[model samples]
Target: MSAITLGAVRPRFRPRRISPARWGLYAFILITALYFLLPLYVMIVTSLKPMAEIRQGHLLALPASPSLAAWVKAWTSACTGLTCEGIRTGFFNSLRILLPSVVISIVVGSLTGYALSLWRVRGANILFGAMMIVAFIPYQVFIYPLVRVFSFTGLGQSLATIVTIHTIFGLPTMTLLFRNYFASLPVELFKAARIDGAGFYQIYARIMMPMATPMIVVAVILQTTGIWNDFILGLVFAGRDNLPMTVQLNNIVNSTQGERAYNVDMAATLLTALLPLVIYFGSGRWFVRGIAAGAVKG
Candidate 1:
C-alpha cells in the first residue's frame, strides 16, 4: 500500500455500454417489425401450401411437400369461366391500361405542379386549392357523372377511356405531390436557370426534371400501384374486351357454381400483384435516396 499505487487510479477506463432503455427500445422495435411482417409471412406459407393442407387451417405451417404446380396451372390452364385460360390473358390488358395512364398522368401532373409552384399565373392558386380540396373527396362521388360524360362523349368502356379516367383521377394527387416537392426545392435553382436564358419548358425539362428523379419514382409507384390494382374504375370503363386481371380474379374467386381452385386463386393473386411488386422492388433503392433527397418534407 505504501508503494504509491496512484498509477492504478489512472482514469477508470469504461467501455461505452448500452443503457437499459436503449435495450428496451430495441426490443420494442423488434416486436413491431414482427407484427407487421406476420401477415406477409402467412401469405407466403399459405400460398406454398396445397388446398388439402390449406383447408386444414394450419396455414402458417410449413408445406408438406412444396410444389410449383399451382403457379404453372395459374399461368396457363386454370379456369376463369367457360374456358381454361388463366389470368395471363389479362396481364397485357392491365399493361395497356397502365402504360398510357402512367405516361400521360406524370407528364401533365409534373407540368401542372411545376407551374403552380414556380409561376405566378392568374387564378393558378385558386385552381390549385380546388384541386387539393377535391383530392380528398372519395372517388365514387365522381364516377356516376364521369360515366354519363363518357357515355355522351362515345368513349364509354374502352382502353382509351380507362386511360383518360386514370389520368383524371390521378391528377389531384399527382399535382399535390409534385407541387409540394417542387416547393421544397431552392428557388435559386429556377432563377439560375432563368439567368442562363432558360425558358419555362427549358428549365423544366433540363434543370428541374433531372433533379426530380425521386419524386418521379414516387409518382410512378403510386400510379402503377393504383392503376394496376384498380378494379372498380376498370370494371366501369374497361369494357368486356379489356377486362383487367382483377376483374378476372373476382370472377375466379366468386363464381358460385364453378369449382373453387384455391391453388389457382393464390397463384392468380400473386400474378396480379407482380406489376406493383416489380415496381417497388426495382426502384426501392432510388425511392430511399429520393425520400432522403427531400422529395417529401414537413
Candidate 2:
C-alpha cells in the first residue's frame, strides 16, 4: 500500500515541461521588466558617478567610483533657484502637506463611503453619480475656479490652501474606493451591528474601520503618492514658501544659468520620487488586497 501511495504521489509530482507558449510568455515578462528597470538602473548609476566620469558619455556603464556626493548635494545645497538651499525645504513642505491631506481625505472619505453604503440617506445615488462624473472630469478644468474661490475666501496660496485642495480633489476617488470596499463587505455584519445597540458612528469606528484595514492602507498609499508627486497643483496652490520636492527638482533640473549637473539632476529626481516608490513597494500587497476586497465593485 505504501508503495502504491508513493507511485501515485510520484506521478502527481512529475516535473512539467515548459511549452513554447510558456517560454514566450516568460521572455515577454522578462523583456517588459527590463524595459522599465533599465532607465532606473541608468539613473542610479549616473547619480553615483561624478561629473568627470559622466562627461565620458558611457551612459550604461557602472560608476568606477560610486559616491553619495551628488545625493548629498542634491539634498542639502543644490541650487534650486536663486537660493543655494537644496530640495530639503520642499521635502519638509511636502510632508506637511502630505500628512494632513492623507489623514483628512481618508477620514472624510471613509465616513462618506460608510454612510452612503450602509445608511438610507436620500439622494445618495445622485450624489454618488455626480461625484463619479466629477472624478472623470479633468481637475485642471476646475483649477481656475478653485483658485478664484480660494482667493475670494482669502485662503490664497498657503499651506492651508494646498491641504484643502488636496482633500477636495482626493474626495471623489477616495470615497469611491471606500464606498466600493464597504459595499462588498458582508451585509450580515451591518445587520448584526444594527441588531445590537451599536449606532452609526459606533459601527464605523468599532467594526467597519478596523475591518477596512487593507483599504485604509491602500488609501494612504494612494493619497501619499498622489499628493507627494503633484506638481501643477502644488505649484499653483502651495505658496512660494511651500513648494513640493517635485517643484524644487524641476527648478534644479531646468535652471540653465550654468553647466548642467547631470548627477545632481538624477539624484534630485530620484530623491523626489523615492517617497512614492517606497510607499508603493512597501505596501504593494495591501494595495492589491484592497482592490481585490472591492475597490472595483459597485
Which candidate has the highest TM-score of all?
2
lDDT of 1 by residue, 189-244 (tens): 88888899889999989877899887888788778887899999999999988899
Point to the candidate with the largest lDDT: 2
Steric collisions counted per model: 0, 0
Query: What are the clashing pairs of model 2?
Result: none
TM-score of 1: 0.80
**C-alpha lDDT values of all predictions:** 0.80, 0.86
| TM-score of each prediction | 0.80, 0.88
Query: Which digits, one per residue and each the tens of the lDDT, describe model 2 over residues 183-256?
Result: 98999999999999899999999999999987788788778877898999999999899998888888889984
Specify the poorest-scoring 10-residue window by lDDT in model 2: 1-10
Angstrom error of the Cα, residue 171, model 2: value is 0.7
Q: After superposition, how far is residue 298 of candidate 2 from its true place, in Å?
A: 12
lDDT of 2 at 61: 95
